[model samples]
Target: MSRRSILRIAAWPWLIASLAVLVIGFREAIFLTPADAAQGDIGRIFYYHVPSAMLSLVFPYVNFLASLAFLYWRRRDPLKALAADALALAAAEVAIVYTTVCLLTGMLWGRATWGIWWTWDYRLTAELLLWLLYVAYLAVRRYSATGQTQTIAAVLSIFAAIDVPINFMSIRWWRTQHPAPVFFGGPDSGMDKTMLPAFLWNFAGWALWGTFILIFRYVLERRRQAAEQEAALVAIEASLEISQ
Candidate 1:
């Protein structure tokens, strides 16, 4: 089958799965999960907040791999490069959304626990920097023309990848103020077993959605490139006819 057909096939599964995940995740986070002993109902934000924050961290790494694939091995594997470009754009967009969710949830969680909306704590600062970088990368892509977008975006993606680690480490290294990790094995690691499955389900759902978005964007890019090639060919033909 053709590339376009393959992309179409890939898209639908993700769309369906993403919808299911959203519905299930919403139900579980708000109504199903039990409240934390410490933060009460507000702790419910973890269902959304942790996944969003983790995925935001994860997407940049995806973008970094894509950038490397495009810049280096692309001559032998052009599809890899194109796929990488598509993934970068998709991942970046998703990261923005997830990061926004993280910030919002963090604020709500904070009000319940810390009684403040904003703080210069390590995790928060690092997350804020990450959000800024994503915005900058997107802005750079927008200002660039079609011919330049991929290369510039690839460079930006590479740089953006660095922020993920910084966000992860800021609290560990500095001990500046934010509470330690909670989910995996941090200070507040005693999680209700029920919450674990919910976390995994939501993570899987967001991941599937992110992958679907990437593939869709890549197909669009391919079509755009094909159109440009066709236009060039037409211009060449017109020139030849005029010459004759």
Candidate 2:
């Protein structure tokens, strides 16, 4: 099969999987999952909130690797560089979307648990800062020129990756009630039996969904780059003809 044919075939499973996750998995998570004893009905938000927050933490690391690949491309392969930039951009965009959801859901979760819309807790504060960093990275890409945009984006993504672990660890290092890493506490923390399966299902679903989104975004970016390259070639030929 041609490359185009191969891509189309490969995308079929992702398409079906995405639809399944969206239609069946999402409803099951929201409606069927039992409420936490402590948090009550509001705990349903966990399906979206926890996944988005975790994804936000991870996506930047993907971007960081892609950015590095883009920056030091020894082969000077435009396609490789393009793939890296495209993936990085996709990861950043999805991370931003997921982060926004995370923040909103977190606030709602907090309101139920703490009776407040926001908190200055260490982990929350650091995550908020990380959100700002991704926003800045997007803005930098938008406002800067081609090569410069890539350079700055790479640097920002790398920096953002460094911040993720710090944000994750902040709650433990400082005194806070962010509920530790485990959802129902730790191994000895006594979790509700039913909740774990739902959480794990949703986590796997999000991982699959995130990959689909990044791949789709990468294809779009590649098309745009290809068009620009064609335009540049056309312009060069036009200038040469004019000189002749």
Error at 225, model 2, angstroms: 0.5
- Per residue, candidate 1 scores C-alpha lDDT tens digits across 81-172 of 76666667766777787788889888888877788998988889889988888888888777866776777778877667877888887876
What is the clash count for each candidate, in the order shown? 0, 0
Against the reference, the lDDT scores of all candidates come to: 0.77, 0.81
lDDT per residue as tens, model 2, 1-244: 7875677788889878866765665666767777677777877777778878888888888888889998877259977888788888998998888788889989989888888998788888888988999999999989876757888888998878989989877865778756576543457553466776667677777878888888888888888989999999999999999999
Name the lDDT value of residue 130 in candidate 2.
85
Question: Clash pairs of candidate 2?
Answer: none
Off by over 4 Å in 1: 73-83, 145-149, 184-190
Q: Cα lDDT for residue 238, model 2? A: 100
Model 1 — which ten-residue stretch has the worst lDDT?
182-191
